[model samples]
Target chain A: MSDPSSLLGALRVVLVGTSHPGNIGGVARAMKNMGLKDLRLVAPRAQFPHPEAEFRASGATDILNDVVVNDTLEEALADRTLVAGTSARSRHLPWPLLNPRELAGRLQDELRQPEHRIALVFGREDRGLSNEELQLCHLHVHIPTNPEFSSLNLAAAVQVLSYEVRMALVEQAETASRKEDQPFGTEWDAPLATSESLERFFEHLEKTLVDIEFHDPNNPRKSLSRLRRLYLRARPDSNEINMLRGILTSTQKAAGTKK
Target chain B: MSDPSSLLGALRVVLVGTSHPGNIGGVARAMKNMGLKDLRLVAPRAQFPHPEAEFRASGATDILNDVVVNDTLEEALADRTLVAGTSARSRHLPWPLLNPRELAGRLQDELRQPEHRIALVFGREDRGLSNEELQLCHLHVHIPTNPEFSSLNLAAAVQVLSYEVRMALVEQAETASRKEDQPFGTEWDAPLATSESLERFFEHLEKTLVDIEFHDPNNPRKSLSRLRRLYLRARPDSNEINMLRGILTSTQKAAGTKK
Candidate 1:
């Protein structure tokens, strides 16, 4: 039901520990290019209204003028339901990583919820997102730049991401209006089954299967992980999850001496 | 069997009469980000090896070092099968116009031919493509900018196009590999029917129709133009074009006419 501009309005660009004033201005310029209005600066190295920052902002002075500065990362992302951090290198932990395009698709799904806001967090130009900062994010976004020369300027990185978000939102709006290839309307759209709900379902299913002597919990193999992948791939809806749980409940009851 | 790298190798970025050294550096950085290795600068204002340009180029020093500077636009676009001029504003003449995404699709089609090279020409930052320079291109590329504030930086424009081309090439490579959704392999893939063949087919179709009294040339009520739209939309492969031409010929012969 929401327009692209509304979706864009709900999206915020948060920069952490920005060193250069020109890049701050560049980020503002880039955000405005994609009709994104909100810019949250977290502990910037440079002061606002610097000459270089103003010079680089070009005509996007409004975005620069209206920026919200925060002293901490938590404050910058306080109201966001979904947070994605930008990182160029691999991390030790295999956090759920998504490329820019996949992140856009996830945004499209999340933005359907009323008043839901998303934050795209960009790290320092030199060292990238701190482990603590990155772990706060639900997903990590990688831009997929050339491996040999992937040191993208902070502003250029912002430009690339904002452009993609704009493209994705615009394309979604066009598809919604045209209704071509898009099956049904928002009326038929099923509520997305949350990760918590999915996890709960998995736990319940595992317990019920063990009660029915179908699964041996003592020496469980890769079945749990494999089934996790299968179900996640299915992206089951809330209704589908409820039906599945009902089936499991019946299976548990069918077992001898099981309530 | 061209890889994305090969496609990028065949593609060239030609900047015409660029005035800013920083923008030039930024362009190189943007090009490298999208795996575009070739850059041709036509009569730049700033001197080569400028410190500011180098500084702005960040880690993409290789792209900056290997740039080919030409005295004329012709040299920059030499042997390019498709030349697209980037213009921010609308011009008087109705040149063949395409947005960035469509331009990528055209590139995908054209690059299939042997030794095919394409030039994406970026004009001066302030003035954009001059009438003379724009005329040199076969198509005009207009990035859809926010009307309220459409003054995109020159390097930003380059970044947008380069990003789009990279995405398009990557998507094509992924599609080719999927092999599931695609109906047949590239060997079964038909060569796109050339304009010459389509034009010839149209001529034959028209002449045969006129002789058989199926079409009246005297008072054509936009029939031919409409049919042109139809066939063009279909984008028939060589085999389909020949089959269609055969049907027209048989129809003409069935009407007892020998041309």
Candidate 2:
């Protein structure tokens, strides 16, 4: 499933109640560093046109100058298909905490689908996103930092998440393009076996083990199913499968020689 | 040969003709974040008691309050050895442009030897280190960024360079501890392969490749050399070496069957 729109430009970064204009400038700079350009500021406390912002922006003043200012949070996220709010701590709300890596993985999968315009919503400096604001987002992303001191600056939070997203997008694109070049019929061409495939492999493996007297056939309840599942969950590759089969063949040959 | 007399506290960061006192405050904050306590300012345009700077300093007001005001660049670097200037662009001067990573590598090597206190000199935001100012340093450290747009803030530059120093210190300490734990004669107990063992494996591998007609005995120049370097760079563990030897033996048997 090839996406028609590019992932880079489709990402809308919305910063709500940004106290310092310089952090807004820093966020824009960090976003541009990771190839994201669309920036929106909602209900900012400081004047963004201040000379301090432009000076701190370095080369990313364009992102600041062209930023869309909104009065309300709803107006900022009206156009977005999916919204993810950044949170450092888990709230009492039932919203599950998706760490940066997990969020990136989910985003990578979502990007493959069409018309997926995602918005990364960040809260103010002093207090993070309110519970009502958290409810607006479909997912909550938490960056895994030192547990004792997880106080990440607003721009630093954006930097880490945006960096992970950019890396994941590039990696996924490279792998997809490589897969496209290879023929689709051969075993190698088949999608690499995931955990689901390994589960099916275990069922077949267990039956074979019982047939070969490797497990106790007399007591059906004394099955080696746990061992089967453990090996299958490891998700051994094709080369590993060939190596294991070779060992099994050699063992059988040695047993025949003894007989 | 560690030198005990090296002036650890002599390394001074001097900011000259700074337009904003808040940036001076930010520089102080950045310096403290990297375990640097000493800060010197030379002719700041903004007043020292600016409320914006104190507010922006967060808890780092100590750095701003105790800042030493200098009259000139000569006064700043008067008592320092091995002054290094930072710039993003390469000047025609014979001074090599070492990036943050390269500078850290050089500092790691230099810190091992006895030398005067190293001074990391930074310039104002408007115009970076002038030609004459740059000439004062033994070397120039450059942060590799976009060539078309390479303007980094004065405080940001200090933060990045200081972070590099902190990382280098931690890495040097870790290396020293590892060396103490595993001395020369205890090479067998070390997790990775020793140089002698790796050399033996490479010799056997090269001979096997020649025997299997994978490498040309005559006119062998580039390919084998590259392969050897690749393996040497990999620094394979004992288990990996054993696996490679097993594969080589299997390949030899397969070749014999074909013959």
Candidate 3:
């Protein structure tokens, strides 16, 4: 029911505490390259309309001219449903990390929902995403540069992500156009399983397993997580998940256990 | 023989007929971001070390400082063995156009050889690589852009390509390092059929078919090509090919009586 081009409109490129105006200009041009328009700067240190930025932006002044600068990151991300932070370094605590390509695909999937707003947050050039800023984001995206010299230019990182988004949109458009004559893909018969449905199914499965003594609730090692990862990777559609849930219910009933 | 990081040394980012110094600066920043050092300018309309460029480069002054200026494209590319020209628009004559990722892989494959120098040439901001300039380069690299507004900022284009190269290098390094302990993959036991061996098998199979009057060579449509494609897709290993050849020999001997 949605077109990939509209996904661009749903995306917001947010810069937090950007020190250089030229980098901002560079990002604007990068966003324009991918047909992305929304630009939100969270308290930029440099002055806006700095002739240097305009001079550097080249033909993408349209993006810079319409740029939105907020006093804080929360204000910039107030309307965003999904926020992804860019980081080159690993965190002390493990967080779900996505490369640019995966982030683009996830963004496209999220945009399929009604009125979903996506924010791709980039942090300061020197220190990268702060722990507070990182925690606020739903996912962290790493561009994957050389380990020896992994200092990717901020604008270049933006360009890489913008390119990935453009590619994802183009792929979706092509797939849609190609499917015009006849519907394809095995999953076309069933809508993709919703997040809430998957969560419910996991809860039911866990309860049933614990009741049946198949899983130890107290000492539940990585088995549940492994299963979750497997299911997520398989990406079962609604019908498939429903069938599996039914099987789980039946299995629990046969075992004379309550879920 | 070479690591991905060394590839940067062998690569030269060449900009032709650049009108703005800021773009040159932007290119330098992009190059430096990806660990690329060599910057060659061919007949720039703007003066060298323009303050605007310095202002825009942020901290990549080392790249801008060591820039090589030439009056002609040929002079800039004289030392390079592999040259890839960047173009945004399609041309009258179809050239071997590769997207940034494919170009990066091809560059990596080419760089496997000793003393190989590669050049990534970008044309002016307004009109991309001229027909004459294109003819000189071995391949054309096109960054996939949004069709609605495909005007990619020159430096952004540089950033995208540079990022791809860096990613490709990192991926190669990872794959190499991962394979160090306990080698994997199903094909490790047997070497895959070489192109020459596959071609010979195809020729033999075709001759045997004609000998048995199964395929009329004179009126053959796409049968030969189709069979070639099928075998190629299968990607038979040495043992598989040998077994298939033995089966074909037996089948031919049995079909002689019918013929």
Candidate 4:
């Protein structure tokens, strides 16, 4: 299993036009509490070196010290392949609205790929991400708060999003290396199969089912496809793959004998 | 439905050991945004007159003006019957862990009963509710956040929990007065029957269910009792009592016919 620390390193948190230094400090503390260390401040109104920020940051000053201060959102997100903006209100622009759970699943898939760098961007405290700013990201994440009153603070937004990212990474890592006899150290040479690999397996399994007439080809409503999507969303590991494939093979043989 | 404004008055937010004045201000804005005005601060570390707090509060200074700062926890909770503590971590003590959804359900019940004050307490940002402090609460409400990283900011915690309370109240109020031609005003007394009357109906209904063998006599696993407790907790209106009783009769008849 990949260590949470390594996954945290790959994850970057961007805060834009943060009005309060204490919020920056609070965000840093929130990030650290969830094993996330990378924090990038985008033109914060208050100076980061202020005593209030330090006081609020408490023990998380290390994260605050290492934060990358940038003047623009584009600069903050230049390296990130996957960028998610958090908003309580729906925008006029067309962006996929993913609840926290859906966003977590998508993040798990994105993080497994070696080439993906995930960035979670939060806007100012007063008014959240502008439509223009939200357009910069691949996905829009809405924390399923009360629709009557859904004003989440900057640090709290960071905390919720960061916690989801950490959870997905941890669950993925645990599922990947659960079979190892010893405690697997943080570093591992072998890459666990990616989502693409699993997708390929599902495609093969579906095609085989179609060939065996288990799935109706002409009038297919994509039940097999939906099942594949569900498993892909789950991000199954090697042990799970073996067990599932074994079950499929045995079931296929049993059907063949009956025929 | 009950007037949204009257229900707003019943929401009493109690913040414990609030280290930052700005957070208190921000919380005021959050509460005001959701039509909630009552805020009770319990032993703030910093002085309330801090400029940072007022600056962050924006236009919610009225709420700040009406803020009641208490010297002790007992003082803060003196009038409240239903107390819910927000905690991210499990406490050493054996208080039941309830997520926001479950707590919201409980809060809705409490809101129905007149002369009962409800308080939602949020702890300091650094170390959440201490074991001793958590034990003071009848129920510990967890937000059901990402398990890997579940750090919720003090004001944000207030916002989410209060928002849930507001929504639950609105929903219950609406379902209660769906047939009413005139909107119920914020005043405690009205033409409709109060929550106390509704409680009596529930008592009668439970007894009727028991007499008819709808509820198991030997192994009555507290499910019906829990329902009674829930309605008692919610304190229903006259209309809500009538609607629920109607549902109970229909369900009883359906079960009888199937048997």
Candidate 5:
């Protein structure tokens, strides 16, 4: 599998009908802090690239400069495989409602497919995504705020959700590294030997053993079968299998001298 | 354990030498959204009741209204039983440094005593808390952010930490019936090969290798043992081992025909 940043980079943060330009700037800063670069605005109410936004962005103006403006949320999420909408209330929707942590876990699973892209959609400041917008998303994410005061600042909401995504990626990388320590991970230098290459190796191996007089044709034994099992268990990489084949060639040459 | 709101209400948010009045309002909003009400300021540069702070506070003006101002950090955390300071860097300090999530877990354990009062202090906007001030706290809490772009907005930092606190409290309430689930180690399509199947494959393999003149009978070079090691590492499932045995049978037939 690829690095966690690869997954983070594939995530698209879409803001729909954001009323305040300052919140846009704050979202940029929050996204940059968590290593998320993709930012899309769908029909923003205020003028972007405004001084207030740049000031709020602090030093993440680069994110603002590169922001993509889409006329509709559908265009922003057209290429995305998974779309998750942020909601302050989970009870109102009959759809799947996940807390931020659960959302992160789901995203990690979805990103296992290399080409998969994810979009985390946030709605307007005063009101969240409309029913139509919510229906477009596969799942709804709730930040689990105080019920009485659940109105999270637009940027603050982005910060919390993005932070969870980053944490999830970090944890995934850590788990992969831990599996490497256990000697079972695919993070090795070379790819495993394919079935075709392994078949060729076995053919060459059997021929050489017969030529070298190590294996008797008239009186067959179980040695060849045992050796086949051993090779299969070892799961030799392509390079290792080539090296074994070379050794078989040398053995064949020596046996030819006797003939 | 006490109710989450009770612990949240008992917790104090102290801002030290904060220069921006707007950020103060942002902090108040973040705190209120997470069910934290106690707000204290230590020698703030901007006016406490500034219009900008009120504007940014949104509807969280109640939290800003009850904010306590103190002359020094000491006065601000005088009554608090536990103190956790926010830091961007966790390396330099010799004191206990915990990530936001870990800090929340520790705080949950510490807050078990109903009489306990905890203080989460934020330093100046530009320089953060002075080393001397950090020394006064029990531990440092670092929000894990992208190392390349680690300048978190003041309010965003508060929002993230407060979000963690709220999540920790909510999770604590749900822990009684919660089951531990691993995020990785995806389920496999097939069960692993049984030892019996593996042994049968091994018997077929050894005979095939000998027949092909690859393995020497009179003067064996420990090839069987080496191959054993390699195959063991592969950990092929039953289907894979069966396919391997079939390959061995084909190799044996080809070698026999050549002889």
Candidate 6:
């Protein structure tokens, strides 16, 4: 079996528009405590390398030392295979949602492919992830906090999710060690498409829909978003996505010839 | 079955000889986040009414307001029937130990008797529970953290343990309710699409695909089957199916008029 640390290493935490330096430091500590190494920040409102963050990091200063700061969420998630955005209980959009534990379970399943990089994106402290930001993610994760006082401290939310991921990894390692010495069989015939590929496909899909006059740009009733959600939930493999793009190209060509 | 909140309310978190007042406040917030109400302190070094603690507690100041203080661990355990001391791995004494999840399971089992009181004791930031303090407990609970960086921030530790307890209680309540409730959800605003509607939608989808030159009538390549599988897996509601059919009709009309 492959080393579980590699899997753990592949998972990164992305904080977007964080207002507090202390929370970023606390998140570093929490991630280190659970053996998560990668930390990325997008458009943080707080100053990096601030004294408060350093004080809060305690011994986990190493994580803060190598933190990657990005200008946008899309740039932070450009390389990730799967992305899950943290959301509060209620949102206007109906998206594919999973609880923290379920998110861990899904990650564990995805981590079977060691190259499958994943990102858990946390948005602003007060606003949580915006609808536009959340739409970029394949799945939405909601921590089952007390509904009445549902807003969890950002660092605390990271702590809970990191703890769940650690538990899943530890459990997987234990189960692997307990079993006979044999490699796990690959579950999927084809690797899943990356986020970048999926984005391109979605763009092509929107353009083709407009080309065929099926989707009206002037009066869109979130039809594109609904279709995006549908495809994202499907999680098409690389081959399937290629075929889909091919079909879109053919549809565009056919409509152009008729016109 | 007793109320889950009552069980959670009966479980008290005890901080022994804590040096950080912020941790105390943070603990209160974590406890409140998980629906646990009771908090106790034993010989805390930080000032009880410290502003840092109050600031750290966020909106959970109510838990801090109702906090109980004791002079010694014995006083804190006076009324509790079961006690679990949080410890790091590889202590001097080989005592009866359980992971945080196992401790939560034990608590869930003991909670069958509503009168059973429980205490989870956390020690100082620098040093864990003293040998004598740990001796007073029936079980030692260790959080499974990375050995390289073993010390979890005091509030983060509270968050993990409280999260586990909350999960256990929520699961128990869910299992009990699931047996009594109907199999499927009665909460959906729109009823499911009928088989006839789905079949008609599929037929329309096939025709639209052919018109768009996306599907070959002469040289079939299982593309239609794949599309069928995608739609079937989505399980679109009646309104969604109608919307999809409308899109297909629009696509066909656009293609026909262009031709």
DockQ rank, highest first? 6, 5, 3, 1, 2, 4
Chain B TM-score for candidate 3 = 0.66
Please provide, for model 1 over A113-229, each residue's C-alpha lDDT reduced to its tens digit, 9 standing for 90 to 100: 554567899989888789767756656788766666677778887887777777676677766754322111244345545545666787886675455444323334334433443
Runs in model 6 lying further than 4 Å from the true structure: A1-3, A176-186, A215-219, A257-259, B1-3, B179-199, B215-220, B233-235, B257-259
Q: Is candidate 1 or candidate 3 better by TM-score?
A: 1
lDDT of 6 by residue, B113-188 (tens): 7678899999999998888999999999999877788899999999999889888887777777775322122233
lDDT of 3 by residue, A67-161 (tens): 98899876777656567889765664334577787787776655555545678999898888887676556567887665555666677788889
Off by over 4 Å in 1: A1-7, A109-114, A176-259, B1-3, B112-114, B179-259
Summarize candidate 2's per-residue lDDT along B21-60 as a digit string, tens digits.
7777666666655556568877777788688777656556
User: Per-residue CA lDDT of candidate 4, range A1-259, in tens?
Assistant: 5456555767889988888887887787777766777889888888777787886675788887898899999999998889998876567776887866568788777676769998888888889888889999898988644344466667666766666666566667667767563222222223345676676677666654543344333335454544553354334445345434543443344334222
Which should have the higher TM-score, number 1 or number 4? 1
Error of 6 at B27 (Å): 0.8
TM-score of candidate 1 on Cα atoms, chains taken together: 0.67
Whole-model lDDT values for every prediction: 0.71, 0.60, 0.71, 0.64, 0.77, 0.81
Going through the candidates in order, their DockQ values are: 0.10, 0.06, 0.14, 0.04, 0.22, 0.47
Relative to the true structure, candidate 3 reaches a TM of 0.65
Checking candidate 1 for backbone clashes, the offending pairs are none
Which tens-of-lDDT digit does each residue in B1-259 have in candidate 5?
Answer: 4447667877889999989999999999999889899999999998878999999999899999899899999999888889999886754758888888889988887766877889999999888999889988998998877777888888899898888888888888877645443111222334567788888887876766666566444345566665565666766655557656655655555455334
**What DockQ would you assign to candidate 1?**
0.10
Ordered by lDDT, highest first, the candidates read 6, 5, 1, 3, 4, 2
Best by TM-score: 6
Q: List the residue pairs that clash in candidate 4.
A: B109-B233, B109-B234, B110-B233
DockQ of 6: 0.47
Best by the lDDT measure: 6
Is model 3 an incorrect, acceptable, medium or high docking prediction? incorrect
Model 2 chain B, poorest ten-residue lDDT window? B1-10
The candidates, ranked best first by TM-score, are 6, 5, 1, 3, 4, 2
